[model samples]
Target chain A: MFEAVYQYRDQLLHGLGMTLAVAIASFVIGFLIAAVLAPLAVYGGPFLRRAIMGYVALIRGLPELLVIFLIFYGGTVFMTKIAGRYIEVNALTAGIASLSIVAAAYLTEILRGALLSVAHGQWEGALSLGFRRPRAFLMIILPQMMLRALPGLGNQWLVVLKESALVSVVGLEELMRKSVVGAGATHQPLAFYLTAAALYIMVTGVSTLLLKAYEARLIPHMR
Target chain B: MSLDLFLPAFLAVKNGFLLTVAITIASFALGQILALPLALGLTSTRQAIRVPVSTYTFLIRGSPLLVQLFIIYYGLGQIELVRNSFLWPVLRSPVYCAILAIGLNSAAYAAELLAGGIRQLPTGQWEAGRALGLHRTALLLKIILPQAYRSVLPAIGNELVLVMKGSTLASAVTVLEMTGAARVFVARSYAPFETFLIAGTIYLVMGAVFGRIFRFIEIKVAIPGR
Candidate 1:
């Protein structure tokens, strides 16, 4: 009943906090990774471009669940061995790292597409000014690249927010995991799960509105 | 951990292969069947139908499939009414729940892809089909669908890889599929890396094979690179 919801209020809040923490941290890290790898994939030498493409192919193709398991269970033991002590892989850290890695591959492609959209002649213009490729990328190319990829990046954020649920496999006390616990404890699987679904709906709803709002403000500038 | 001793890894793959294929095939067929009509509905101009179709697509597309799977399977099982109803026979089965989850998820995404493909068709083709005495069903079946499939095969192929991976969610509901069985193997073998590595390798190979098949299909209709 309502009492169950009230009883688990603190736990649910704690779980929500963890989910958002991982979602924000992983997405920010993924964006940073994407911003760095994107232009490399687009403009690097054949070998480097191949390396980036190979990375995207491998990570994007592999199951996120497998990656999570690799990092959470497998990496923990490897880390412990290296550290000469017990290095536990808690739910939060694993959730953040695996999600960042997984999201990075997708974001790289999104960003590369955006960067490639910048007219090749722009680079030529930079070259005419005797600006090195790095200087051109730093001074002129990046600011416009951000504008092109912003909407796609927004969609990716929605994905990150939702896919965070999967990290619950590592026993992360996020909404999905908390709902499982709530179901087991309350013996009301239907209610708790439906509630979890609603919570997801809520998060997605507000965030979509926020994205649309931000896009509205920025669209005029792009136009 | 001897690199030389790889029997268990081999055995796990042998054991879990069928379940993996079963989940993939079942979801793929179901997704396509559901997607075609859902796509038509989405692209249709009818306001009544459009609203609900968009809502379904929005909700499913916006949220994570993992949460949807958990909500449908583990969440519904706790319902007294569902337990009491005749649907319980179907609902109690984890396979059915997994199918429902994968079906719904793929339907939403594939519908959008299908819609995009449909839109890509030159409107003149439809008029041409109409001029040739083709009605709605005839034009759609013979003219639009084939062309639409070309534009969408790549996206659908990507979705197929997603479905194959999403099938792992079935493990959460106590289904002893590849990932599920891998968990047990890891616990018993206490070689976490080896077990997971084996599981990951299986998925990668499956994805690689699927990618090649899709490429072959894509070549049939793909525009040559500029």
Candidate 2:
């Protein structure tokens, strides 16, 4: 078992790299979307808030795989029809897009929750200090919100990282797909998958540790 | 604009909805059964018991359920030992593999949630129980566990929603569940948008309904002052 995994070390590493890249890309894109949607969902006027709420609800309820298919297969078809030509949307792009969209929904919720946890008095206090609304939010509220949101953001990152495995169905050669391919080629499915599971466990384990440490560091300051 | 297509597409895939429900219920039931022992193990003081349970939860929670499904469906099936074992009959079916995979995944999550709830019981409660001369098992069963379940009901509902959504991954392993039905329809009709739109709507409805039920439970079961 060890020999089989050791022999495929390079392939596994490459797959790990791809998994991290896809996860990180999704996180960045999702954070950007969260930056827009979270505020709208939390404090926007009625119309904008309702629109964001609907999007979040739909995304939260649907399966990630179905969303991926809709974006990859459905998006491809729609684009090709519009362009009156074949438009290539690769598996990686599809994976990142779908994961980011889902992440954005969850992230919006997390951020909104964190923002709400910040007392209304804090905002009022900032306003009484003659700070404009945007400045008060950025200068007074954002830092505390980041501290509160960090753990949730970390969990969301882990979620995207794990969900990246689903991208394998689209034929992206990420960790899960590579493990499957290796298992098939080597005829040692257990060895390859155990290795894959172990790798995931390791990444997630280290992430939990790092997040805990980060939270610990921030705790004293919060007091 | 393509609203007319949704009815036939939905009709064709409605059975898949039942399959999805079956998978979710079976998996959730199995998870609930297994969670009790695992949750106990999690709250144990002995490193021997705690470490393994913690690691198991960590592992399952960390990885994608898709990989876990593939591992069981494809990975375990490859082993000569497994293929020849008494369990081979059960392992041969993709449905069993999907259930086992998702069930175990859900068990890990459920165990963690229950453990968290158990830990949150006021230490004073346990001390009060001891003062009353209650046996350990009686104390746990009558006092701690019941309150733990109440506290964790909302969290467990969240887990159920997850299991339901996760069951859609069974589509990958040749199970024609709701998502799988949509995949088949798209293959035949070449209508990716309409097929998935209907499927996505069904999932959204299931989630919305469950979300409301969980909220109602949380409010109904709230402790008077707390």
Candidate 3:
């Protein structure tokens, strides 16, 4: 039962690496986009705020799997039209793009909440200290908002890690897809899947612990 | 680009739409039933009960639902005992397996939600019920549960949407839900965008309808003050 896992250990490890790569890449890119969008949504004019809200609502309404399918298939068609020739959208690109889009929407909300939680007095204090608006935001306000957003960002990271599994549907050789192939070849679906689940549990468990420790360090008084 | 496929795609996914709705409703109902006992166990004073309940939720919540679904739909079939057992009749069906997997997953989250609600209630409420000559079960059922559930109503509404989104994974197991129907239609007509757009719209509408229903229930049940 377990022998098949050991025999295919390298494949599983490689798959794990791919899964982490996709998760981290999409998360970092999504966070950058949300960092911009959150402040814009909070401070920008009514039109800008409404447009950002609409994007977030539209993305949140659809299933993540559906989003993956839309990007994977629609992207191929889009690229084909642009170039006047068929160009397949690879699974890795499609997976990252869709997950980033989904993550950006959720993270935007989280960051928006975090930004609002920071007091208006802080902004006024920065202005009174003879700092320009952008300089004040970058030097003082952003750091405090990020600290407040850490817990939510950590939660979103876990969500992204789990969601990365959906990338396997489009043929990305991630942990889920690797388990599928291993189960097929070894004819031991239970063992392969259990191994995958255990790996996922291990990663999430470590992440939770690390986040807790980091949060404790940053906000000891709150704890 | 394929404007012609929109109406036809909508027609094709009509059965799929119903299947998605059925799976979401059934799985959520199943999850609610399972969550009640698990939530009780989570809030229990006994180490024996609380430890195991928390561990179960931790494990279930840690792993992805797709992996869990595969473990049930494909993995269970690998075992000779499960294959030979009377339960195999239900286990053999992909639709049942999807529901069971998703329901179980939803139960873990719901249990945590319920447990949090229970924890939030003032201890005075429990003491008050006990002082009124209520037994443990009566105190829980009559006093603790109603308020706990009411406090968590909005979270429960959110869970409904999450479960509805999760039902899309049933397509991976060949359950022919909305996503599956769109996949089939896309394969046949080579119009992925139009078909998926229609299917996605159906999902959005269903989510909005469920949200409205839950919002109405929340309003109807809301306590007058505090």
Candidate 4:
């Protein structure tokens, strides 16, 4: 029953590594994009703000799987057109791109809320203290916003982690895809899938614990 | 780029759109029914009941719904007992399996939402219910649940959209929901952009319609003064 897991241990470990890499890479990239977009959405001109909002709305409205498929297939066509030859978008690139796109939309909303929660007085005080506007925003306001955004950011991280599993639909050979392959080859679907589930649970469980500890350390007074 | 495929793609996805809607509604209804009891268990005073229920939600919430769907659809069939059991017929169908998997996953999140709502209710409501001589079940059904659900109505609406998005995964197991339909059409026509865009539009419309309906309900059910 468990022999298949041992036999495919290397593949499973590689899959797990890929899953983490995709999740973390997408999340960091998404957060950086959101950091820029959220502020623009909140403070930019009406046209700029509306454009950002539209992008967010579009992503939010569509299913993640559809987004992944569109990026995977459409991107190949797009790049092919650009290069004047067929250019295939690999599953890994598509997975990370699509996930990052989806994550950016959600993170923008979270960060926007956090940004709004920071009072105007903070900005005014920073300027009065002789700090430039951009410097004040980067130094004083951004840190407070991030602290307030930590809880929502933590939840989004978990969501991104789970969503990475969907990338397997395009044959990315992530944890889910690897498990499918193992199950098929070993003819032991239950054992392989159960192991996959256990591995997911372990990562998520550890993440939840770490997030909680970090949140506690940063926001001790809230408790 | 393929303007010609747009109308044909729409026609192709019509049945798939209906199927997507059906699965979303059915699974969401099933989740709500399961949620009430799970929510009660979560809020139970007894550790025995609460611990098990919490664990169930924890495990379900921790993993991906795709894995859960595969477990039910593919993993269970591997069991000799499950294969021979009366439940095999229902479990074997990908549609039913998708519904069961998504419903179970939705129930975990809904239960947590309800539990959060329940915990947020002031103890004054419970005291008032007790003063009126309402029993435990009666007090819960009448006084507590109504208000708790009301407070969490927005979150509940959001969950509906999430479940609808989740229904797209049913395609993976060969259930031709909208996404699956789009995939098939694109494969045949080699028009991925047009087909997927049409499918995506349908999803966007469905989400907007549901959002409006929930917003209307929220306004209608508002407690007059506070």
Sequence-dependent TM-score of model 2: 0.95
TM-score, candidate number 3: 0.98
Candidates in descending TM-score order: 4, 3, 2, 1
Q: Candidate 4: DockQ?
A: 0.89
TM-scores for all predictions: 0.93, 0.95, 0.98, 0.98
Which predicted model would earn the best DockQ? 4
After superposition, candidate 3 runs with Cα above 4 Å error: none
**Candidate ordering by DockQ (highest first):** 4, 3, 2, 1
lDDT of 3 by residue, A1-223 (tens): 9999899999999999999999999999999999899999999999999999989988888999999999998899889999999999999999999999999999999999999988999999999999999999998888888888999999999999999999998899999999999999999999999999999999999999999989888856533
lDDT by residue for model 3 (B145-213), tens: 999999999999989999999999999998999998888887788788888888888888988898899
Off by over 4 Å in 1: A1-3, A129-132, A219-223, B221-226
lDDT of 4 by residue, B38-123 (tens): 99999999999999999999999999999999999999998889989999999999999999999999999999999999999999
| DockQ by candidate, in order | 0.70, 0.79, 0.86, 0.89
User: Per-model C-alpha lDDT, please?
Assistant: 0.84, 0.90, 0.93, 0.94
lDDT of 4: 0.94
Weakest ten-residue segment in model 4 chain B by summed lDDT:
B1-10
True contacts kept of each: 0.68, 0.78, 0.78, 0.82
Docking class of 2: medium
Clashing pairs in 4: none
